[model samples]
Target: MRVVVVPPVPALLSRYASLTDPVPELRAACVSAVAWLVEHDDARIVAADDQARRIGEELLAQGLAGRVASASERIETRIETGNILVMANGSARRSEKAPGHLDERSFGFDSEVEAALAAGDAAALGGLDARLGAELLASGIGALATLADLTVTRAVMDYADDPFGVRYWVVRWECAS
Candidate 1:
């Protein structure tokens, strides 16, 4: 199994894009990460809400277009099977400019989440407090928790940053069946 983790940054959607990307590197990383998932024949998406799911779908669509254009034969698109694409992110209170404003606890909260993701510590992720995550404006805890039982064989951090006070990550995990 393969999994890709990304944030539901509206800027990732072309409709929300500005003339100049506010997050150039992040955007590139997201596109690249989603493209990797598109390599699979199908995928299941996990997100916090409809909007987030839409973002994931948009990314998947973009990836599919690219893939189809390069493929030798027609590609079939399906849903809710194969690799997993999770739309999630850490705290939004890391700094004064953060969406939830500065919270001294945000740093530690984000650090723990980041560590879990980087190490593919499914137990730690599953044990994360949903309430605390909400208080800290973390959006990925629920989805991460669902990964508790998966045995991750490899974890790669394609991107990690707290730009605009919102912690975002693009990580890929290869899990054993």
Candidate 2:
């Protein structure tokens, strides 16, 4: 079954980055956030079918207990039939029916995904992973030891044209269990 799975917002990591200046914390957040993506089979939330939605919800449930975003950031998760979309905006909206261009203002998952794909740099993924990992640690989730344990499964490009301006990449990571 096909699914449109939106990646989770690494709320914990983002908040931690603002509160602290430690590099290890940032790296941990990066690993944890990307590792979560790996478990989902390198999914980029564009749309979803019935089976996909169910699967997405089950996966997201695992991370609910460890939310790391601040009050203002306010991350949100929702499942619709076969479409699972997670965002920090607290609003639910389907991808454009006709498939239009993605604006730079499109939000977290899409923007990052787009930029990552455009850069086509493996190093960029690692860099972002490091940054996110550090952010997560600052948020007080776990140590770098945990993030380092994650395994990156696969990386793929879900490409589309953007009318906005700059292109982006959406790198996926699979962690070691």
Candidate 3:
């Protein structure tokens, strides 16, 4: 199984794009990750909400040249060959310019999440405190928790940064079948 993790940055969507990409590197990373995910005919998106889900869907539509399966949650349970796209980010308080402003606790929290992702530590990812994540403006906890059920054999960190004071990562996880 393959799972790709990306941030739910609105700037990634074309509708919210600027004349000059404020997150050029991030955008390239996201597009590359999404393109990889859509290599298969189908993909299951695990997102925080409807908006996040839409971002995943749009990526598929764009990357796959409009060939996209209707987004469905049940497809994951029904198929074993498709990819999983997780739309989540670490925190929005990594710096004073961060969306949630500077929070002393945010750095530690994001570091832990980053470590887990880099190490492919499912246990650490699953054990993340959802409440504390919310407090720290981390939106990826729930999706990370779901990874506990899977066995991650390898993790490829395609991107990791806090460009807008928001922690973002583009990672690909190769899981055991």
Q: Which segments of candidate 1 are over 4 A away from where they belong?
A: 69-77
Which lDDT tens digits does candidate 2 get at residues 1-177? Answer: 122212222322334344554434323433444345433333323322444333333334433324433311221322222221221111112134312323223345334434543343323333344333232221111211222223334434332332222221223332234
- Which digits, one per residue and each the tens of the lDDT, describe model 3 over residues 35-67? 776666556788888988888777766656534
lDDT for predicted candidate 2 compared with the true structure: 0.30
Candidate 2 weakest lDDT stretch, 10 residues? 136-145
Clashes by residue pair, model 1: none
Best by TM-score: 1
- Once superposed on the true structure, which residue ranges of model 3 sit more than 4 Å away at CA? 66-81
Ranked candidates, highest TM-score first: 1, 3, 2
Q: Candidates' lDDT values, in order?
A: 0.84, 0.30, 0.81
- How good is model 1 by TM-score? 0.92
Query: Candidate 3 — what's its lDDT?
Result: 0.81
RMSD of 1: 2.6
Model 1 residue 52 CA deviation (Å) reads 0.5
